[model samples]
Target: MTQQTFIITGAFLGMLAIILGAFGAHALKKLLSVEQLKSFETGVKYQMYHAIVLLLLGFNYTFSTSTMYWCFTIGILLFSFSIYGLVISDAKGKKLKVLGPITPIGGLLFVIGWANIIINAL
Candidate 1:
């Protein structure tokens, strides 16, 4: 996707993160245990962090949008979505295994994107 489109999506993601944070602090805390609340907060934290990263990637025109944007997108989807699935997996009474593995892969993508930034700086 184009940088502009990625940025717009990042804006939406940022909004979602804020909403999720509020939800976590209020509704989720009441409904979930302390550990689950922490888990949920983790989701919001990663989502918010990568949301900013995506927004920066979108705004930085000198960077290759395709690489940075795609990495950010995939990182958000995998890292955030996995936590969502793990947290709510009881809704369907199913256990998810891939989430643990995939979350780190998403983290690795973030690392790579930052590595690229370092390379550009050099």
Candidate 2:
């Protein structure tokens, strides 16, 4: 995807994260268990983190491209979205199971993205 596309996606994702965060705090609290609430927080945290990275990529358009952008985008979507979905599932009385390994992959991508940026900068 182009820089603009990913950047906009990130912005919208950021807004969603904020809305979800408020929802979790005010609304979901009474409905959700403590563990589920923590899961939601994880989602929001990752979303906000990647949102900042996306904005930075946009600003550093000249250098932020290729693998780093790809890693960041994928990591944001899978990591953040999974957390959101898991929380929602739990809230709806659905069984939330950690069947596959996702967090580690997401973290790896995040690290790679940042490393790529730093390496490119040097």
Error of 1 at 90 (Å): 5.1
Tens-place lDDT digits, model 1, residues 1-122: 67787788789889999998897788666666677678878988988988888888778766755677777778888888787777766333564876779888888887877787777778
In model 1, how large is the Cα lDDT of residue 9? Answer: 74
The residue pairs that clash in candidate 1, if any, are none
Among the numbered candidates, top lDDT falls to: 2
What shift in Å separates residue 73 of candidate 1 from its native position after superposition?
Answer: 0.9
Model 2 is weakest, by summed lDDT over 10 consecutive residues, at 95-104
TM-score of each: 0.84, 0.84
In angstroms, give how far residue 85 of model 2 lies from its true place. 2.3
